[model samples]
Target: MKTKRFSLRTLLLTAVLTVVLTAGVLLGAAWLLLGRAGVSMAETMVLINTLFVGEHDIQTATDQALDSLITGLGDRWSYYMDADSYQQQIQRRSNSYVGIGVTVTYLEEGVLHIEAVTAGGPAETAGLQAGEEITAVDGTALTAENISEATSLIQGEEGTQVTLTVRGTDGTEREVTVTRSQIDESPAEGELLSDGTGLVTIRNFNSRCAEDAIAAVDSLVEQGAQRLVFDVRNNGGGYVSELTDLLDHLLPEGTIFRQRSNFGWETTVTSDAQCVELPMAVLVNGNTYSAAEFFAAQLQEMDWGVIVGEPTFGKGFSQQTFPLASGGAVNLSTARYFTGEGVSLIGTGLTLDQEVALTEEQAAALSAGTLDPSEDPQLQAAIELLRETEEPS
Candidate 1:
């Protein structure tokens, strides 16, 4: 057998072809098992852009891609916001904004309903009230699709005016022009009840929540409040640091909550030496969630307070916002938190010492400010509970 000697050039070509084939096979395997062997996000993005058929600018495409990526995580707490929405979120977290300071919700009736009006804000100053429906913004009809646009229309440079057509609960409609200005919302409000119980309603745990809470509690104490009722009914929750700080003022030196991340890293937030020693009760409802739920759970776990009202909203996951280079942001569910006693409030919320459910009619009447406290079984129950503690045993 005559062995044909291959030339150096042919051998080199054959070796190069072998190397290329091997690399292709490895890459194919990697692409098949991309979840195990992570693929580069940049590479995926390039592939997406090359194949996407929708009409999208680079920014919109990237934003949508990021949003879709987060949505794929299948966690409701994880979300993506565009630049404008991200800025609005930051403003909300800061408890300050240059808008009319009215939070609105789109109703099924194609009306923009004012959910809450910031105290001393342009909306409140303009006599806007919660539950009022906004029909139009500056002559433009506000639909569910364009409610966000209407919100943008309402917000402008300080000193600018935005006209809103509002319908009152009594079916009266009128147009009011409100001048936008900087509004600072207090995170907590407190007052001493007639029975010497301090009623502190925490709006949300923003950055200034702890400070506001301290001031409110101190003021209530100065007004001769002997006990406290923390009303976190509608509070959806905010920064974890703010919650921890507020807890430090209320709880003695102990672990407030424990956070466990996906990587198995655990963190325990502890209270400081300073604490508010008043006998307390926490008021909660279906809207009470996240840090608010954590607050009630911690207090109940420590035997510091009696929890009242219905079961909580049961949000145990903690979210973290990551700012993108495009000025947008992504909020991701980074961890799940538990009470100091190792109780998780994810789906099954904290059971209250007293469970009181408000009838739909009563709730509607309460929202309309027509339901008397005498008829509000939940509030009455809390007051009775606290007052019983006040009475001599």
Candidate 2:
């Protein structure tokens, strides 16, 4: 009876081992099949290696490898973006992201500076001031580059909450919580001053920018504004079509700007609409780039407006995005644009008609909310030029 019990136990052990081996083989075969059936080789190998080596988590290892590889490419501008990041960038390009609608800039010292607050945006409503330094975003350190990335990340679906840490010019850090909202991002906002002058600020050339600009100009005209100041400071850029429409309303019947590709002088945009024949001034600065520069250069070439402020940002290269199968895209510079007078503004930016320099005290005073550029001496200079050019009809 004891011999029979030992034999039975041996038989049971053999059956258990056989089942385990069979299951292992089946799993290996399934993995191989998946590899053959269009699974990413890197992902498949990572899984298999993890199973065999029993070292690291497969997903973590894969992400780390990808991050390392992308960073090792030695291009600071090139980065590995996940699905959320990719979606956010696409939304920003399409002008549909929900944020506080504050344009930001990075100073040379890695400080995240607020450039402008869009009218009717959450930032404007929150009373965020320009020249304010962002100290942190949701506990993340706010370096210039990190702040830019964080801003994009903080901007989410409508009604989301974004906690920001701000350090004002007074050097005091405070926490500010802002709820994201969909604000009307009209590219232009204008009104007639008491002196019959149009005070217009061009935000960006988005989808409805030109229409908004025309409406602003028309409203100012109805309000008896005879002179115009087109503010394009801190304007990044947007739709080329919208820019064309804007120039058409401001420029005479002639070539506005020229685009040169490898094919050599591919296309020239012209003004089809009647010009708004008024004494105009285009405001530009170092932050003004791309479509803003295009508009400024067009007006400058046609002698339609006097450009005031600092030299424009020399970003004349045009980029186009191509989607990839992995749900990501590449923004590659494909062509270069030039002014209507055949001047390349890529490396050499457009010079201003008047160079306005602010003293350190003036800059500090502006940061402290003491000085407003709308009432600035520089802007007053532009308005005074309009006053001098005012002729009785």
Candidate 3:
């Protein structure tokens, strides 16, 4: 009866082992397909438990194994997220965060510059205004190199208070304390320049980004925008749906996006007939990525606009989030994307029609959101090209 019980226990362990497979791939396929690889993850796991050195939890070992496997794929854009981290990532993608009611940018002066104060939010209540620099947060001096650290210093549980040292544009400094709250902020914004050119800056392509970008452009036209400049500098891309939708808003009837997956699947997204038809340009920088780079490429390729600034740091892969049986997920690069012209942007990013480099001071001011439109060389270059493109009216 003891021998019978051992055999039953082994069968149960082998059955349970298959649960460790993620995306319904990897180990199970390894066990069945090589005609098998990993020499049976079950056998490996059982051996680790019975003979491996040191303390190890089976669940943790499984998680690490999956993590390592994904990391081994050598795609910097892909990775595994544990359940808690995955939830946090989802919250970030939703474009909401717990913070004082202010939007900030890291200046080259090693401080955070207040770009916009949310009306009636904690920061505004504490008298924080746009153009002020956050010199320090909770006594830790803010720095461009550690923007994330400074951001974390200021954010806390809702109703918690954080102290900040702020400097106004005039150089006057003061310390203020403000309570934090949940803030839903979209970084996409539009402003009509003094010369009637609409300036739309999209910092991210997440959440309601498509809606926000479309609205910004339409509102600018309503305000008598004679031309348009889209600033996507420092933009790291987000959802594909958002990118395509925004492209549809700006580009006339044509293919806006093309993609191919590992399984030999291909697809394309086309825009409608209606589109914004103003003289336009897309401002980009090296930090521009993924959908942002593609946005500029499509415009330049279709003769709708010119690209200004340094070439984009190209991204050819599109990722898909695959949930693991482990309750976490892996963001795997599942598809290769191409420009609207069916050109890949992997090694060669979008070529700039005008390669405008920022001066040290100009870059600092740009980061602080304090750079005047009249003072930005890249914007000026784009405006010049657009002026040449303007029809006699």
Model 1 Cα lDDT, one tens digit per residue, 355-388: 9989987766544445565677887788888777
Model 1 weakest 10-residue run by lDDT: 364-373
Estimate, for each residue in 1-393, the C-alpha lDDT of model 3 and write its tens digit.
344646877888877776554636775566676454356666787788889998767777787887898899899989998765576578678888777877677778688878667766788889888878899888888776777567668767998989999998899999999998887877588999989999999988889989998899999999999999999987888999999999898889999899998888889999999999898899998889988898898998889999999877779999998887778999999999987779998989988888999997777567656789999999999999889888877
- Tens-digit lDDT string for candidate 2 (199-224): 88787776678888989988887788
Residue pairs in clash, model 1: none
Better model by TM-score: candidate 1 vs candidate 2: 1
**Candidate 2 residue runs with Cα over 4 Å from true position:** 1-82, 106-149, 165-174, 359-374
Model 2 lDDT vs. the true structure? 0.73
Better of 1 and 3 by TM-score: 1
lDDT of each: 0.84, 0.73, 0.85
Which one is best on TM-score? Answer: 1
Model 3 has an lDDT value of 0.85
User: Positional deviation of 208 in candidate 3, in angstroms?
Assistant: 0.8
Model 2 clashing-pair count: 0
Worst 10 residues of 2 by lDDT: 362-371
